[model samples]
Target: MTDMPDNIVMPFEIKPLGVRGRIVRLGAVVDDILHKHDYPAPVSALLAEAVALTAMLGASLKFDGKFILQTNSDGPVDLLVADFSSPSGIRGYARFDADMVAALKEPTPQALLGKGHLAMTIDQGQGMERYQGIVALGGVSLTEAALGYFQQSEQIPTRLRLAAGALAQRGLRPEAWRAGAIMVQHLPRDGGISPQPFDSGDAPEGSKEEVTEDDHWVKARLLLDTVEDHELLDPMLTPEELLYRLYHEDGVTVYPAVTLERHCTCSRDKVGDLLKSFSDDDRAHMNSNGVIDVTCEFCSTHYQFAPEEVEPAPEARAQAQ
Candidate 1:
């Protein structure tokens, strides 16, 4: 097998394409986001891609912000989420039925999601409108659906490459699994036309400008379609090496490697606040004698709070606040 490289920002470039084109580089952090959740095979795989896609897209945002990817489905896989910050902090979660997930084999987003929408939320963090896009979860894998969204919605030539296969756990976590992914996007340009992916001629020409665009789109499309599954999931390929291997001939300038890790923000007190959201009647029903148990699905952090712990919402009440 070909060796891969370590985790880093990999490299990216933001310059003019034919006249004014933009590009981005995404690395393996996508896999890291999925490790925090004990997702079913297919669910985890899609979530990992969503996470990587979010990070990759967020990396290209013009302002300071975060990108959130979420889904509300009705299949064995109930919910999936991925969050990425501008500087590139990645986090994700997947919720599914224990019994059903183990026996799951569905890969189609429609089959896995039943009926739902794919939402992308961007928080500028400065009181901006916080861009949000919601589209039907239509068709096969999320990778294909997301690429479609980029084309029709965001109006960008984007490629989302993901690897959500199982990874050998470290230390005593033997049976555990990990995921990885990478995203590449060609941002929109002023003119309706962008550089042709692979054209070996000076003053690129076609039947017409539209024809040139179609040709350009086709050339790039072919190159992206050629990306193999091995290139995406291989840990040894490091972000830099992967880019150089794939786009070197096309003249890609990698930026720098970005560090990534898995994070869970659940807390005991936070769980209590969630329980408080329910009405007194609802809370009372969930309570058995006194203890109200709350478990975070992402990290499996269990928090138990007695009935007495549920109190009025006072800034001073640790749980209420």
Candidate 2:
């Protein structure tokens, strides 16, 4: 909709600094996803960040595929799943123990996710190979974890920032969840730059070496660090304006932006097929009264199926007989 231009991913490059980047901002699209589940504020915020990051990474796919971002941890908020389908569909949901979340002393990102791993998966449709990269979440923010994924898995020097919160006008409207993210990767003319290696404390003494970052990358990273949470989440600020504010000194070039929307892939037929895949015992356990109720986690859509509707033809015939 022309009235809602906030949901978009803009790709850009800073030629002088040899850095390529993407900026993702979600307004109504994220709000709808968050509203579908009455999750706690902290959980919603985390999910918002996950969704924004998914969009940024998914937009880079050169083919028609899906990008999935998931986290499994031992914290109050244990699981988060967000997926971006090619051509601009994004949806995500979060799972958490409300009681555990309420018991937290401070709902910091670390406290919410505890010690777990973050996984980034790329699915290039059926028959195509799926690629996944995982990074440990110990003692690091989500942004840092993603950076580590790129550093170790892709060996690319990367910097990222993510922010999400509820924004509202004082009197006109209620608060709505919004998210924004910016990521930059070094792409020097010399092919690709290797990221510095981690210092393994177990390494034999003197095996450690100091690796210096390129000056241009250092400048770009410093500029990225200067970004504030509000600057990223501000609906009033266009992506172009923010890019100019961040990299006008080096001359930033932006390509056409890709629009994003809230789209759930779940359908009645799909759910029915999934239910039918379960064993008879499983399906019997799931049955309630005379119907089977199904709720989509992503969109909170509810569907009801008659027993015969989801049962295999042989099983249905046997039962009828």
The positional error of residue 159 in candidate 1, measured at the CA in angstroms, is 2.8
Per-residue lDDT over 1-321 for candidate 2, one digit per residue giving the tens place of the 0 to 100 score: 245358999999999998999999999899999999999998999999999999999989889999999999998888999999998999998999999999988888888999999999999999999999999987677888898898778878888999999987555447888999999889976787735556758878998877887888989989999999999999888888899999999999999998999999999999998887777888898889988999998999999999888887787547745
The per-model lDDT (C-alpha) reads 0.60, 0.90
Whole-structure CA lDDT of model 2:
0.90
| Model 1: CA > 4 A from native | 1-11, 14-38, 62-64, 98-110, 168-171, 175-178, 187-211, 214-218, 313-321
Supply every candidate's count of residue pairs whose N, Cα or C atoms clash at under 3 angstroms.
17, 0
lDDT of 1 by residue, 6-57 (tens): 4334546433332112222233454445555555567766676566666656
Residue 92 of model 1, lDDT score? 77
Q: What TM-score, over all chains together, does every model reach?
A: 0.75, 0.93
Point to the candidate with the largest lDDT.
2
- On TM-score, the candidate that comes out on top is 2
